[model samples]
Target: MENAKSMEYWLQESALICEFMVFGALAAAIFVAVKFERFWSRGRGKREDYVYDNVLWRPCWRALHPAGLMAYRAIVFLFMAVVLAFDLHNGGIHIYYFYTEWTFTLVIIYFGLATLISAKGCRQLAKNDSIRNQDVRANFLKTDLEQEAHVTESPGKNLDGDSVKLQSHQEREEQKKRAGFWGYAMQIIFQTCAGAVMMTDIVFWFIIVPFLTNEHFRLNPLMGSMHSVNALFLVIDAALNSMSFPWFRGAYFVLWTALYVVFQWILHACGLTWWPYPFLELSTPWAPLWYFGLAIVCLVCYTIFTFLIKAKEKNFPKWFPYAYQRLH
Candidate 1:
């Protein structure tokens, strides 16, 4: 009895420590964000102007300077390396005693492949940005030369021909639309994968496993390991989602998460019977309160993360595109 009580005490203490660490990290993130934002809003210096006339090299320089682009790439690579190393160290192959080993292996492989593919795509995007910038500069120069020639032909004539000006404006509008569309698509893809991962882990851990096992069934060692891995993935997803915001503007992700939580809560409240997950059966006196508190904490963490990314962009003006300059 004494040993059992001691073990329970240690678990409670560990839980409390974990909670403190999470909240502390969130607080620090928020503090950093606020300080950075204040510093930027003060306008300490003028933004460095990049001459767009250099057709070949200007894009390359600009692409390299963006706030989170390079940092994100480095972070993802390092994270993947660490995960791969850990997996190798654990064994050539680790199996879950409870869940199917195939399922566990599939998830790891899927994410690993995804990280590799995304890294390649980001490099390509950087290259494409450079090429696109060169094209735009070349076109602008050609347009200027044509306008000057027309004016020189009739010295008294205005250089701004209505037809030419209208055409140029239309072209600019089209470019803007294209960029926006691409940004939206990227955000959708990123958020969908993130949400899927989260929902899958939640259901797999809290619902499926519990429902499948009897009370006497021992908790799967693999399930705990998987949960830890998923948590780390969540952190990565959060960081990436934050970075992807520079390219896209949408509320769909937030809406989807909210709707998902609501659906889960409603199902639980209806007593439809899901699993042994704490949230599903709030027979514990403080379970509902604890869950609601956790939701609020998540919201605050998200807000802080968003602010930090935005603040970083503000501090480094060159990191963002012209379209974002005004907003920042």
Candidate 2:
């Protein structure tokens, strides 16, 4: 019996390590493909209908350009729904409803918010460049031409064209809408959610599920896929969405985990003796140290994602399908 248990433990460990490698390779391939823009131009012999962006994984994203953001969000929203529903079905509403589950729910909400924004802005996004160019032409060149023909300059006087330039400038300024409160809220929420997704899942696979899950616990496919599924979906959305993730946003990530810790403590106080995660339990003498260590781990996870965004901006052009442009 002891040997059987040992062998089962090793089998689970091996499978988890394999999953880690597979997901790592997929992420690396995506990072490289997007950085080099390898598939942006062509895929072969005069076939314009060929696979463009994400050629290695075709049909994941489409060719509709601006609408791609909406598509990506939609897919993420659906996958998160499945994960959430499956989790709720598995455990109902117990105290063991873990932090990963909450974070996953947060991600679903963020994706829903993103999809709403994308749907609202799609038409304007599609037409922005052409409309701006036309406005420039009308304000600078065509208007100046008309002024030249109709209102001729005096002998030693000249038309400065300042009014036309100012009008064009004002039009451009009007297009620059400030990202008001909700926009900024969504930004922080999304970045924090991304970091939480990675951290919570990593802990689940390596620490909780393997060594800590009860001996008689029977795992379903959805339970097995939870950790990788969270990270994979977020990475896909990261690859296909244009969002600016600043370094300071890591503060929000810290706040999110703090909230989860507080919630767990509350649950413990309210007659729940068991913790969803062993390291999170406050019954030990090392509880404070465990909390501190977990906080540090969360920060590291957040920093890793911040660096991922930095890599995207540094390696690729601003105009790449979906990436933030660095300020000059």
Candidate 3:
């Protein structure tokens, strides 16, 4: 009873730390948004000028364009539902109910708040641009006949007889050149971090846990099945990461899986199991077959996840970042 109490106390403390980390991340995200707004506003001479100034920020407002909002909301809510289901299944309410309820609760709350703020910013920017465009049109309409005749005589003759297209093209080229080295570096870092987290979670769930649990290897059908299911999810997670960021997908998954296997082997040799998964006794040749089958299942799961992500990208381009723009 005392040991159980001690374990409970430790878990409570850990959960508190996790909560702090989540809030810290949210705060940092907000800070980044504010800084970007300030910097862009200063550079563009007006807040509205910075709104449609960059292709990178286009995803935030893509939801407000036609049916995009419905898809965005659906995907986010589905992800939240999955997280909630996992928490409930893992006894989240009972275990951390008293000690860290607010921590887990705040994750969803903060995410929603951030999304709403971004959407509002996009809407305000759009409205401002519309008003500015109207003002420009009115000025053009009031121009004297000679001025209008000169404008129409230009080489670039659109229905509006404005040279706006050439100016827009030139501006795009300038913006591309101005996106310096630091921007590219930060993009790579962010992508790498996301990939690393997904890979770590997979290693922890499948390879580390199963290899460490003795009961998992004893072929107790129920335990074996549960372990299999957990492993399957880890594989799916890896696949999802790869699909979401396709540029380094193959390299990240392959390198991380190799590293995780090597680490597990070293742990096994030392008679130390850092994860909770049960390992099969190596004495039986059939053990290799069973493990191999689990590996195949993982591969299949990855394939399925890749297809799903591709479909999602087609439907909601804003859901994921553009790897090329982000990296360069």
Best by lDDT: 2
User: Per-candidate TM vs. native?
Assistant: 0.35, 0.64, 0.36
- Which model, 2 or 3, shows the larger TM-score? 2
Tens-digit lDDT track of model 2 for 1-328:
1121233422454333433433444455354433432134232322212222211111222344546767877787987787688778867876145786788788888888777766656655446556655665555665556667868634212223544555566445533443444555566567788789889777777667777777434456776677677777777676655565655456566656766665764565455555677676543456556666666677688887878766766665635555333221
- At residue 232, candidate 3 shows an lDDT of 42
What range of 10 consecutive residues in model 3 has the weakest lDDT sum? 95-104
- Tens digits of per-residue lDDT, candidate 3, 1-328, equal 1122233422454333433433444455444444443333342233221322232223323223412432343355456546656657755454232111222233334234324433553574576567557755664555554466776554323424443654465446534433234332322332333333333334435655556535322434432333233334323332222112343233333333334444444444455433233322232335445445544543454455455546655654455554312211
What lDDT does candidate 2 reach at residue 160? 35
RMSD in order of candidates: 14.0, 14.4, 13.3
Candidates, ranked, lDDT: 2, 1, 3
RMSD of 2: 14.4
Model 1: per-residue lDDT, tens digit, 41-96? Answer: 34232221111111111112233433243344346446645654565576454322
Model 1: residues >4 Å from true position, as ranges?
Answer: 1-175, 179-182, 188-253, 262-277, 318-328
Clashing pairs in 1: 66-319
